[model samples]
Target: MQIEIKSLLKSCGVTSIMVTHDQEEALSMADRIVVLNKGRIEQIDTPDALYDAPASLFVNGFIGHANFLKGRTSPQPGTIALDAGCALALAGTAPPPAHRDVMVSIRPENLALVSDAQPRSIAVTIRVVMPLGAFSVIDCVTASGEAIKVSQSRAAWSGRPGDAAWLMIQDISKVHVFEATTASPSIARA
Candidate 1:
């Protein structure tokens, strides 16, 4: 379907502006991604940047699966103490709002299964496991009931449901922190 649209655009010599609710469709069709929320433009950037470095929490959750972690800000500098026993170091130097509720967005693919040799291993219990063609997704919950989804290799887990797994976030640097949005002003991102 995407190839057909691209071919049509090329043949007609027309620049098309396609609006789609599906994020994959938008990523495949548009050269520049425009993310709109509630009839307002939230972000306009390249596809890679839009996905990797989302402007806000709505953009991050819309582009990919985001695990919202509750955390607090550190007094010293660019550091956050996250729930589920993790301390996140922020890339930006500015201090976050102190004593306020914060959420961190981390992509599923960035979380990797780790062995004992790895440094950053966090324990989680598998609630459910669903196998796609290329990758297997493990639905897990931390000890504190914060749900986490990790996309791992098909061969990573051999057991059925109710198994324990430890994952070491391979790309911690990719995690982003954003101010939480409320229901007063609903925002949609695509």
Candidate 2:
């Protein structure tokens, strides 16, 4: 499809600007990504950075489903704890000055489902289970009543709806932290 577009543009002897909401298609075709938010350029960077290091909370969520939780920094190095009334673990080195009103994005693939007893694992109750060809989707709620969705291989899900499970977020390096936003409620990660 991208080749076809490029050829079409070349044939027209005109430079073309393609617009799309699908990040994957844009990333694969465009030389550089121009992210627009409500007619404004929120960011213009390579696809890798756009995905790996988003410019804002809106961009982070727009690029993909990200988990944003309220958190604060600890005096100790290399950790941040949730102010969401539960202990949660993240997969990266602590950011400078201990972030307040924190927002973190955790991609579904990086989430691990485990028994509820695991330390720093967010306790959840299974709400829905969907099986895709290569992955399974599990919708669960944290103990604090926050919803979370995780996509894992079919083998990982051994419990049924109403059963207790834990959604463990690891590999903090892959997660991106954004400045918290209160203009609207943040969507739970899926």
> Could you tell me which residue pairs clash in candidate 2?
91-171, 91-172, 92-172
Residue lDDT tens for model 2, 83-166: 534544445545546545566567787788997666677777989988897789888877666677788888877788999877
Residue runs of model 1 more than 4 Å from their true location after superposition: 91-98, 115-120, 183-190
Question: What's every prediction's RMSD, in angstroms?
Answer: 3.0, 3.6
Which candidate's TM-score is highest? 1
Query: Which window of 10 residues has the lowest lDDT sum in candidate 1?
Result: 181-190
Residue 1 lDDT in model 1?
Answer: 79
Q: Tell me the spans in candidate 2 whose CA falls farther than 4 Å from its real position.
A: 2-15, 83-96, 185-190
- For model 2, what is the error of residue 117's alpha carbon versus the real structure, in angstroms, after optimal superposition? 2.3
Backbone steric clashes in candidate 2, count: 3
lDDT of 2: 0.70
The Cα error of candidate 1 at residue 189, in Å, is 6.9
